[model samples]
Structure formats: structure tokens, C-alpha cells
Target: MKKVIIPLALCLITAACGGDENDGKTEPEMKISSCYVVSSSSGQSENFSSPVGMYITSEAGQPYEGSGVWSASYNSGAWAMDKPVYVTKAGKVYAYYPYSSNDSPPVLPLDMTRQTDVLYSRVASPIAPGSVSLSVKLYHALSKLVVSVKGEEVTGLSLSSPVKCRFNICTGEFTDLQSGQVTSTDGRLFVVPHVTVGKEMIITLKSGKQYTYSVDGTEFRAGESYTYEFQLNEDRDKLEILDISVEDWINDNNYNDYLRR
Candidate 1:
């Protein structure tokens, strides 16, 4: 079941929080300032770097059953929940968020697939697609890339809606959350999904190309934010860029609302 583009709903998302009257601290800011592209299991604050960090599991890609610190007693000297959560690979502190699971959390080793979302791509110009900041390091034992799409990434651009909210990082040809196609009216296409946190789309660009880019999402309950980033080819993968753009069959509003499903 594909989802049709809802201009009204999109307007609501893109315009949400712009004129809110609540206490207004603003949504979590969506910006997570880190030092390195890849996080290290053990290192100083300056030496440690990566997008997001948390104690992960070696076998299963999930958060470790790390309690003590999570208990909130760590600052008190003892271990407790709520205290800053740290991982080994980069020893970076992973922000804690309430999820569906609680018992035995799955901490992704080098690859935080459990916290990755959907990835998108399209050909706007002949130039390649990528970001400048590599939040997390591509740990051969972890993942190919660990990007963090903060508020700075998507500034002026409008976020339509929650296209895909997940943390599962996997390789695939993703569907657009807003239009579902690779191309838009003006020829500019949104290759990324409409969701955030828990998801990072990945794809190989033209054999040789590079570009600076950013990403963001609009949230009715929260404000809209963008992430400033850039991407360059790594020595790991040797695949050529899949610079395929989608047709305008999308955003038709009635093309196939069920297709996006």
C-alpha cells in the first residue's frame, strides 16, 4: 500500500511548532555535537569520536543490559540508570531514550543497526551525494558508516512528515516518505525518508564524486530541524553510485497512497 502525498498534512508538519504557544524549550534541538567521525571504545573526550555511542552487544546489534550507570547512581558514585551511558569501542556516551524493549537491550557492536532508520537517494545534479561530518567511525566490526543527522542538517528545507522513524541501518533502495519517488516537480528530489533517530540511509554514488549536504524532518509534536553533513567514498566498498532518480508519478496525491505502505 503506497502512501499519497498529503499537502495539507505536510504543511502541518513543515509548519508545526513555528508558532507554538507552549513553554517552548524547543524540541530536543535534534543536534548532537560529537568530536570524531567514528567513536572509539576507549579514549579521552577529545580522542573519542562518533555520531552516537552506547554500550552495545557483540553478538546482537542492541544496547547492552548496562544498568549501574543507567540507574542514576553513577554520579552519586554508585551505578544506576539515568547516569551517562557509555560504550567500549569508542567509550562514547550514548543518549538514553525510552524504547519498546527494556529487559535485555540489544547493543549493536560496531553497527548500530538497531538504531538506524531508512536511507534515500536521487540524482539532483551529476555531482555525487554525501555529507561532511562522519559522526561515527566505520568500524569493520561495527558498520560501514555511522552518520548523525542533526537539526543543522535540514535548515531552510521543509520536512513533510514522519516518513520512516526507526534505528535499523541496512542497505537497500528506500521509498520516499514525502513523495515516494526519486524526483520532484522542480527536478529536485528528496532521496531521504521523512523520519529520524534510529535510521540512516546509505548508497553508493557515482564512481567518483563528492558533495556537501544536510537532512532534517518536520514533527508536529516537535519542531523541524536539519543536519549539516558531507560524504566521501571509503576504501571499503567498491560499488558504483546508483544515481537513479524517481519519476514524477509521486506527489500526484492520488498516484497510489497504498504503495508507500
Candidate 2:
């Protein structure tokens, strides 16, 4: 009777230890199968730059709980996180390029002088557990302005527009607006998406000549590109509007035809 009781006690101890081991085991890490940027106009997909910032929240507008944000770096033609991320429950994922170091929801100030192509993506779905794969697609969040001179060479070009705004990374919204000026020599400027009413484009020639033109009521939208071609008339000392074309930032089929004067 003593031998049987001792053996049973040892068996119970072994079973208890096995149960603790099973409870201590963690869930499998979530995997990101593919991450790429999709062109809003062309529907074409491409890989974004390395090191995109990601944030996972339990719900929309909810703050990230637990460990905080994750960094997804480009590796071997794929985007991967620096460490393992476990999505034990349902949550939403947000990703953006030109990763900001800020832990909170990133709010980027609009700077026309040093413009960059801002890309963002949000996935609002239940990410199941047990080695789940995620596919992310980022889109452009700003408008592109391209100015081309057809007739004469210009020394300087500047735009007097709304240069003040704040871009919210989580919601993909722009707020806090003001008016200012931005100078560009290459005639290419990445600007915040807004209406073009009352905005002015100033061009200075090599002979110290300056011309200012008011842009009409054209609303610049996100992921769109606007091209303005001007022919400098030496005889009249005036700038003639040769053509104005609007296309996607990725340069796809022109949605709007040329507006000629």
C-alpha cells in the first residue's frame, strides 16, 4: 500500500509540472507576408522604402497597449519587424513611410521647402492568432506640383500658397492651416492637399524680370500630380499658359485634359 501511494504521488507531481509548462508557452508570432505601396491612379504596386513605422491598436482611435510601436524594416525583398510581434487578439494595424521616432500618433508639420512623399496605410480587421500573415498597402498622402518652362530659362521660381498644415498619421488628415511662401528652383514641389484658390506662382527670369500669376480654382487632392507648362514670351514680356495637365503622382492615364490659353 505504501509503494502504490508513493508512485501515485509522483505521477500527480509530474502531471502538475507538465500543466505549468504548457501554460507558460507563448503564442506564435504574427508574420507579415508582403508589404507594398499601391499607386492610387494606376493600381500598380511597388515596394516602399526601408524601415516603415507600424502601430497596432485594439480598435480605431484607441491607443496602443502593452509594448508600443513596432519597426518593420526591409529585408531580402520583404518587410519584416525587428523582433517578433504576437497578435493574440483582434487589432488594427497602421503603417507609414519615412518613419517617425515618436511613440505617439505622429503629426508631421507641412514643410514645402523640404517636401517628401508621405505614404500611409491602415488595416482594420481581425488579425487571427497562430502564425497569421499580414499584407499591407500604403498610399500617397500628399499632392505633387510640377512646373515646366517651355520658352525661356528662369533663374528662380517660388509659390505663395498655404505652406502651413499638420498631417495626422493615424487618420490621414490635414489640419492647422495658414498661408506662406515656398521657393523651388526645379519647379517640382510636394505640397499639402488643398484648394488652389488665391494661390500665386512667381517666376523670376535671368534678366531680373519677375512675373506673378494667380492659380485658378483648382483643388489639389492627395495622390494627384499637377503639371503647369508656361511659354515665356520675350516680345510681350509675359508668360503664356501653354498647357496644364493633371495626372496621378505615379504618372498614369491623364484624367484631366490640357487647359490651354
Candidate 2 residue lDDT tens string, 66-156: 5457778766777678767776666677777666566455566766666556778844434656535777777778877777667556666
- Listed in order, each prediction's TM-score against the native is 0.21, 0.77
Model 2 spans with C-alpha error above 4 angstroms: 1-25, 106-108, 122-126, 151-157, 204-210, 251-261
Q: For model 1, how does the per-residue alpha-carbon lDDT over 1-261 read when each residue is reduced to its tens digit? A: 998787797788767756576644432211223322122334212212111222233223333334411211122322223333222232212332222234222221111212222111111101111221112222211111112222112112222223332232222222323322121222122323233433223322333222222223321111111222333346433222323222111122221121122
Q: What TM-score does candidate 2 reach?
A: 0.77
Pick the lDDT winner.
Answer: 2
Cα displacement (angstroms), candidate 2, residue 255, comes to 21
TM-score of model number 1: 0.21
The local distance difference test score of model 2 is 0.69
